[model samples]
Target: MKKILVIEDEEFVRENILELLDSEGLEVFGAENGRIGVDLAQQQQPDLILCDVMMPELDGYGVLTTLRQDSILATIPFIFLTAKAAKVDFRQGMELGADDYLTKPFTRAELLGAIASRLKKQEAVQEHYNTEIQQAKDRLSYLAHHDSLTELPNRLSLQELFKQVQPQDDNYQEVLAVLFVGLDRFSKINDNLGSDFGDSLLKAVAIRLKACVDDQDIVARINADQFTVILAKRNHKKDAADVAQSILTSISKIFVVAAQEVFITASIGLAFYRRDSIELQQLLSYAKKAMLQAKQQGGNQYQFYTATFHIISVDYLNLETSLRHALEREELVVYYQPQVDLKTGKISGAEALLRWHHPQRGIIKPDKFIPIAEETGLIIPIGEWVLQAACKQTKIWQDAGFHCLRVAVNLSGRQFSQIDLSQKILQILRETGFHPQHIDLELTESMLVSNTEVAIRRLKTLKSLGMQIAVDDFGTGYSSLSYLQEFPFDILKIDRCFVRNITANPHNAAITEAIIQIAKTLELKLIAEGVETEAELNFVCRHNCDLMQGYLFSEPVPPQEFEKLLFSGKNLQFSPKQDHEAKVR
Candidate 1:
């Protein structure tokens, strides 16, 4: 029910008005003076207010002016009930923001009709504003999930699409294929012509590519020079191969971009998974890797991704048993891989990688045992040890003159899930005498997706302590663009799979460049992993990548070797003349 407040100096007028409104089924309030009416309005926040024009300590004009100053009460519909109905009095009330004026001794119909008209108009205005707000929200959501140039579904949209098309039954065999198509040497077009031409070419390609697939099939532009398609149908092995060939042939034809005839070829990779279980991300990764292989084999072809599965042997029991003691015996060691700053071509920081040296096994990679440690809940302790060690090493280097160098240490999923993770790291920092600013913690994308609220809270706590955070192997997991926008990350590390052959293979180059653009747009630091050649270095530098790490600089090495490089003042020898000459001119 609507609420109405009546303010009049005369007891009869106020009481009679309240009784009439009450009989009309409205919750009613009455006050003998304007002062009491203001107090009641503040308390009850009435829908509409009726006041006497000339009476009481505070008259109708004063009350309306005062209430209009309040943000909450400013929009309330107000009507003045007055014995004086002169032209000047009506003008004064209207100028004070009154909704309507009801002369004294008026009919009951006049009072109720004024209130009804004001309330109806107010509701219509509110509905219009609400609709505008909803429309703006929808537009923002669409822009967040789509590519601006081609207006095609991007990585985040692709992830949501996968969820809808996922196989339902666990026991029934399902066949799904992911095809990654990369335009070979496509960057040459941008370099020779311009970005406008390149953008037009990509838009044209998006149109033709969509025409090649059925309505049920999914097609999306995953990167600048790459497109991904999903064939979510049973018995799709042969059909997958045919689709790849069709896309390759379709993309190779000439295109009229900017009224200029342009020709391009695509190298397609087909990865089909036929099993009772499904992993969409894994299939996409395989297709990308296979596309790189196709590009390596001279391009203009399609390659089927093949995998070798290893049978589980009984050796894991002993390995697990040995890992329990590995930490205690000091068999685990930390290695430092230099992260080179592309702007200065100098070592700016190092990522601390953990390694194990078993007496019988010689050396063991982290991938072989990290999963085991995670499964057994051993990663919490080991991860803490690594953080402490990395921090202490960073302090040592800082004392030795590399004052600006920071150390990045990876945090495992198990360690990050702990409730007191931030407290534990803060304690380690205090114990190691290391400043939180000089150490960076790296986390995988999967670790943050499970419990976003918890992850955001923990990340905020760590950030409050002045520590930097990075997202490691970014493209390897299904991280949405909104996720990146929500998380407080200082850096984004491109996965090796996206950085391989970035210079010669358009597939990797396109993904690598797109990641760089995202980092730039978000104002986050970027690090390209696995940049192994001068060509790769040039590719990233030409696009203004912030940092890079790979064998081209130095692999993850023992502390002694890393110290020697630090002492020797070894810096990357590179020149930016080739990349920046045009801009400089």
Candidate 2:
């Protein structure tokens, strides 16, 4: 039952209010003075507090302030009942956090209505606080057992749950199934949205995922944008696959938040657990490796751990070990892909792409080891290196007579969240002696969507440095077109998928045209990526595309080769082979 505490020194008025509330189906607790009222409040933690501001022993302000100091009672709504009618008195009561103020000789209806409003407000406030507290607790609990971002069971949670399903000493036959789910564009979300909003979207995704699973199954957020599910001991691979599909389906559904709808997808990696020799971390590693393989094959899919995949994983582990050394050894090279002015066919700028020159592996692709770096937080250092390296190269290019050419470096959304990224970039540019206008930072759509405010602020700061900002993979994102104007971007790189079919597919052509038109309207440069054919090039050029980059112009070539191409002046070497070959670049 709802309870109300009434504190008034006047016997007649205090009793009258108590009787009125009592008759109105509420439990009324009366106190003769403010001191006793505060004591009763701490003890009862009543639904509401009604106190006369001018009471003896302790004034209403004193009682309210005292209770407000205690976190437990701070939120309990307080109403002031006083004979003082001056605006100053009312102002004082409000400043004390009084929910409402009732002057002396108030009507029963007016008093009752004020009391009712305070009670309702209190109820609403409590509900909101409870939800926030519960969310915080859940977040902490999730962090304890799972990856805070992915809402996947953490290493600890996995170990605890894995042990529960481990076959006993007597039974070697029992097997436990585990599936690791990874999002293809989860980092994109973080890269586009600031980390907080990225975390919010992830938490929301986690809730959806949890709702899709069975009560008996153990699912936890394990790693960044990775979910680990411990299926029942006897659950079949097909069953796990079905659940994974359900998870993908659920997350794929448009999530309408803050008046906008967003969509996301995940890739699953599955492995069975054996108590004989396999450890928790080993199983998890295997699962994640398999998931990476699945993502490599193309996301929105699943892969089961197999001996063949393990062989690849072993190689990848070796690569990861070598990657750290490669950074220290300065074996990581930056390749530049030229962006050409579509109308004049002039070399406008270049995107600085990273390549690992592994001593044993020859050349390593970004897709092969980038995820590992991101997962292990090596991306922070690698990204810093990329930024500084790109700036250094831009300075070198300027010294070598390419002064006007801009060098665009991709910034991982994670790098932007470091609180000083803008400053860091500016410092790098200053230290490297690169002209700020000759550098561009390519951020993905996900970074802008995840945290609009932070991303905007960071980008704005970067823009203030006179560096251009471009949104990479523009078409394939969750950001709304309405927010397009708010972000500090100078260019939009149309995703290759959209550009790939534009030549042959009318629908794709229309979408690409619309994108170009939007860019034109915004007075932003439009770069059509992944163009593989003359027909595609012609289509883009016909639309007056500002820039174009793909194999058609040049695959991301080494700096030496790129420089040679510049010296040799081979402007356009693109020759469309066949209509059938007109696929993804």
Q: Please list the Cα RMSD from the true structure of every candidate, rounded to 1 decimal place.
A: 13.2, 18.6
lDDT of 2 by residue, 177-211 (tens): 67788877878778876766676777888788788
Which stretches in model 2 have alpha-carbon errors above 4 Å? 1-312, 572-585
Candidate 1 lDDT for residue 16: 91
TM-score of each: 0.56, 0.49
Alpha-carbon error at 142 in model 1, in Å? 3.1
**Highest lDDT model number:** 1
Residue-level lDDT for 15 in candidate 1: 88
- RMSD score of candidate 1 (Å): 13.2
Q: Pull out the clashing pairs in model 1.
A: none
For every model in order, what is the number of clashing pairs? 0, 21
Worst ten in a row by lDDT for model 1: 576-585
Error of 1 at 412 (Å): 14
